[model samples]
Target: MAAVSLTAVPARADGPRPAVLVLPGGGYGHQADHEAEPVAEWLASLGIHAYVLRYRVAPHRHPAPLEDAKMAMLQIRSESSGPAVDPTRVGVLGFSAGGHLAATLSTAVATGNAALDVQAAVPDLTVLCYPVVSCTEDVHQGSVDNLLGASPSDDLLREVSADLHVTAATPPAFVWHTADDAAVPVHHSLAYTGSLIRAGVPAELHVFPHGRHGLGLATGDPGPDQWTSLCAAWLTRRGWTQSSPSVM
Candidate 1:
């Protein structure tokens, strides 16, 4: 399938590196500019090809963001970067609402069991920064309600909750959340990480104290600037940074 449309930061001709697919946070309303674009540009500067995904929201809910994310992955895989982007080295990075999408891609959307009329698209790994996981627990009420429609029931959330969907096949993931995130509670990442552990999936998680929610990928006040370095190192540890691209 062809991509609907995308904004890409091409790899430097000299040496392309692992690619990152970024999904911006908007509480299922709109794509945040700083979260999506600024982070992409920052990643590009670090020698990685960063793709900023402006996925659909609100009036287009549930499977819409999931479908758009899959489309983005499909587009990245379809390209032959010519010594650039080892397609398999591609990873998904999401924030807050976007983090839920990333977790969805890694667990639900990629699994081929989705009830949507969409392709099975999954990234090699997922990077979820301050993700919203369970609707029943640690719920980001606005995000969950917007994503599933106004009267979304508990069953609806049970069906879409990233934690509930994790399985042995779920892609490896790198997760982080601030203990002080009042917007989206820290339990979101904690619960999700617990599920990942129970499923025996390869995962790395970090819980930093004091950095509030929606920091994008930048440092807040002081400290935690090392988060990116920590993430980059985690990718390296998983051997995900050097994986060769493959046909979907």
Candidate 2:
């Protein structure tokens, strides 16, 4: 099983708290420190349980990471009725390549088998930060090569590109990208957002004027720092926050 570090606060007096599965992007090379524990801590501070998944990458490839993502979702859902979490409210958030993984889960359908379906591991909601949504032209080459290998087949490429797979059944998404990101172009998010809209799935997207790729939390970057606050508000709007709906 993939390693999952749980960050859970005490259960609220009212009921089970909502939770998020956080995936940090590293171009399928490794997980980012800034995007991992820091994000979990922030969510926990808001009374929402968080799980940081140290999913396999690089040498592992494709379905391997996806499988890990599914496992984490299954584990969280398994304890949904427990005091620790609200199964139905579980969601996912990812940065860059991790965003691609999260998007894959959002669009992936259940296979109808208990073990394989794993109770249909799709997240109730998704947040993609500068995600590499395409395996084609808009792709992040390093991430594509790492995940799908060099010279992947056209069919395989199409199959893995999360944007091409969106459907009305896919969960709503909140996506953000900086226009100046050279590594993973902003168009990736734009195209994915367009697909979501065409499929009638609820989606929100923000395109900032400047910021580089992999700027997790964009701490000191004034423009990108707003993303955190905006995302918090978006979460609140969906009632995913542990406390009453209010922007953090």
**TM of each candidate vs. truth:** 0.86, 0.90
Candidate 1: which stretches are off by over 4 Å? 1-4, 13-16, 80-83, 110-120, 240-248
Best by lDDT: 2
**Which digits, one per residue and each the tens of the lDDT, describe model 2 over residues 150-229?**
79999888888888989888889999999989899999999899999999988999999999999998899978899888
Q: Number of clashing residue pairs in every model?
A: 2, 0
Best by TM-score: 2
Report lDDT (CA) for all predictions: 0.77, 0.83
The Cα error of candidate 1 at residue 1, in Å, is: 23
